[model samples]
Target: MITYSSNQPNLYLVGFMGTGKSVVGRRVAEALGMVFLDSDRVIEEKEGRAIRDIFAQDGEAYFRDLECKFAQMGHPKRGCVVSCGGGMVVPDYVRDLLKERGVVVVLHASVDVILERVSEEGHRPLLEGEDRRERIEALLQSRQGAYADAGEVVRTDGLTVNEVVRRVIGIYRLNEPNFPL
Candidate 1:
């Protein structure tokens, strides 16, 4: 069993859409006995609108600005689990800020897997185009370096939600000094 210190820094989960950040993050937070926060959800709540609406009404740049603000001052507690949106870590400043605050784990999956998982969701602003697969591929390729630089990388392909949560907890445990193996 792994026990977290009261001083344990928050765990920030960063990944593309459909990589299970929100789903896995909830379980990880429950396991760690901490609060769970999703950045996109926070933004939506603050703006009184959905993310897709924000993007459509205010443009991606405006949405990115909101993301940066959230990265800076949205989180209200420590020893929590934060799940960031796909494009949140793309900005160097945001990535640096997240890294400074806590462990940034990048959850990843193949483009095909991402497409399959996100195909049913119509709320993705970036996938509003005709060829969603192509958009996903292009976005993944463009953001690959940023994701790699975010933190420890975990592949979610062919893995169940519990398996992913276990892996994240294992990785997190390795960073703690008082964890009992």
Candidate 2:
């Protein structure tokens, strides 16, 4: 029954790293006249360190717990575009929670595109080791189901940021129970 009216509802963007979540999220927030937030950035500000440092010092389990915490109550429940960290929606409860809070859109790109996009970024903790392609493939394969159930899936490959933003808004509008998809 929850649907966006004249006011902007919370919009969540979830997917693997380098899938244009943050970029498209900013544009979407601008188009919708809503606030924009990146979960990773928020967590980093709160923890006072980079995510790689968090993973290195406390390990991934700890970082994941932080992500869960953020999903639970770290950000506003409405009127914002939340660009979630790449595995934030892996947990069913968190994904379900985000869906209930608002629209959860999964922005996806092919493995090659992901590789190309993230190849230069040294902040990826999970993809730091050798054989990054293999790692991305394996991780994507493992989270396929979770991502599928996350909400609306938007493929970002070959699409401009504005294009993706438009598509996300379109999807969100049609997601109301009474509206046609």
Candidate 3:
């Protein structure tokens, strides 16, 4: 088991779009009595613009840089759950940074499920102008390795929100006993 300091075990939920990271994260945080933070929301607040606007004005690379900074900023509260953006774990540095700080869990779902969940979410700039399903499929394929390399992979396709949150709490306890989730 990884021995973390008193402030360790910041649970970071990372995966492709529509993977329920934010929703599950909020629940897990509540269940464990920890704070919940969404990295994208943090970026949106700091940048003074919506994510779509950030992408439109600055491009993905710039947005990614901001994400990396946001991830590294280190939340004030220990044992918090952070819902990271889909592409956040694709960067090795970002993954390593999270690993150093705390546990990172990848929430996985089938491509069809991802497509279905993200269908109505028009704010995703990457899925904006193209064949949305194909784009999401391609993205999932591309990020599969990085997602797999995260702390643990939780397949959430058929699970209810409560089930997923319970799974996360269990995983947290099993994988990170030091933090006492």
Candidate 4:
């Protein structure tokens, strides 16, 4: 098994929207005594605008460029629980970078669950002006390959946040034995 020299490799949570990346990442960080950061939040804070605004003003290409930039060097190199944007790992380059930077755990949920969880959420830019279920299905299908190859998988369908956090930490510890509890 590959071992991290620092023994505090970042934990990257990647998955489709509504699959609990942000929530799980926060709790996992707390449990592990690490800092937590949602990549999208960081981008929003830096840009001083919401993601929907960015997509509307600059277009998806520009927003994706931003995601790539963040993947490259926009956050701490280690010891952080990073909840990646759902599409962050779609790019091969960013996927490779995340794998290199730390342990990656892809969170998953059923389509129905996703629809239910995100139905009332207005912040999802991609779902705007489209049938929510269809958009979620298409997005999930397109990104499934990338998510599958990203790293270990954890289904968050019915699991509580704390349970998911424990599974992620188990995966983390399997890779980084010295990481704090």
Candidate 5:
């Protein structure tokens, strides 16, 4: 695993949709004085199109390939807090790629919480449909195991953002004690 000079491992946050990877990643980065980046945003900027457009036009296979490429590009010059797209970790290759770079933390939420969190979000292309909740539940069932296989797993049920950040930081320190938070 890649190690930072401060003896801290780069934190890559992975989770199902609506688990607040982006929001919590920002908070974690700020708390740890590290940079924050979202892989989906990077892909969107690179493709000059929204993720929905890419998926709608090209297909999920194309998007998944790009996601793998983006993840393989590795972490920042210093340590960074990376917020991966929801489906990014479903593939085993992506999981291995992340493991090589630094610590992987999967943020998990119950299906009900996930559905509620994503219900009003129009930008979530994957969750669009008549039975969005059921779809998300099915996806969660398939991915929860892979997510659990990551270096650390944090459930974001009743916890505050601060609590989540603290838990992540604690996990990072445990994984790479050489790095300072």
Candidate 6:
């Protein structure tokens, strides 16, 4: 069992799609008695449409702008768990913003695992074309360094949801000494 410190900072989860940021973030927030905010979900709610639609109707750049805006202003308080979109931290400025806000944990999974987890989901605009495996590989390769630079990296491959949550909490306890348990 781990106990946190006195200043509970926000927790930001960043990763490729299907790496369980939203799912695991919710659980971590519950464990820490904090609010959970999914950037994509918040954007969707604000736009009154799905993210896929936002991409199609506007464009990836527009959607990414929304993501940046969310990162800038969406957070309501500290001691919250924020699950960022897969591409949110790809931009250096956005990545820096998240890192400045709190402990940014990069959740990672194998390409195979990512494909398997996201296979059933057709809503991913970036993975729309054929050869999704190749796409996933390429995107992961491109963003690998950015994710690595975000903060502590947690590999979620073959790990149960509870196990991943525990790992994140452990990382938080280790890195955020000013944050109380």
What are the models' TM-scores? Answer: 0.93, 0.92, 0.91, 0.92, 0.89, 0.92
What digit string (tens of lDDT, one per residue) describes model 6 on residues 17-93? 99999999999988887778999999999999999999999999999999999988877536788999999998899
Error of 1 at 125 (Å): 0.6
Error of 6 at 86 (Å): 0.3
State, as a TM-score between 0 and 1, how close model 6 is to the true structure: 0.92
Candidate 1, residue 138: how far the Cα is off, in Å? 0.4
Model 4, runs deviating above 4 Å: 1-7, 177-181
Candidate 2: count the clashes.
0
Q: Write the per-residue lDDT of candidate 2 for residues 29-51, one digit (tens) a residue.
A: 87777789999999999999999
Clashing pairs in 1: none
- lDDT (10s digit) by residue, model 1, range 16-71: 99999999999998888878899998998999999988988889999999999999
RMSD of 6: 2.5
Per-residue CA lDDT of model 3 for 6-101, tens digit only, reads 364788899988989999998887777777899999899988999999999999999999888887773554667899999988989889888766
Per-prediction backbone clash count? 0, 0, 0, 0, 5, 5
In order, candidate lDDTs are: 0.87, 0.88, 0.83, 0.89, 0.82, 0.88
lDDT of 5 by residue, 106-163 (tens): 9989888888888757677777765887888788888877888765889999999889
Stretches of candidate 6 off by over 4 Å are 1-7, 178-181
Put down candidate 4 lDDT per residue, 1-181, tens digits, no spaces.
2233434889999999999999899888877878899999999999999999999999988988999999999998887889999999999989999998888999999999999989856678899899989999999999989999999999987788888888998998887643343
Better of 3 and 4 by TM-score: 4
Q: Residue 12 in model 2: shift from native, Å?
A: 0.4
Error at 71, model 2, angstroms: 0.5
User: What ranges in model 5 sit over 4 Å off?
Assistant: 1-8, 74-78, 178-181
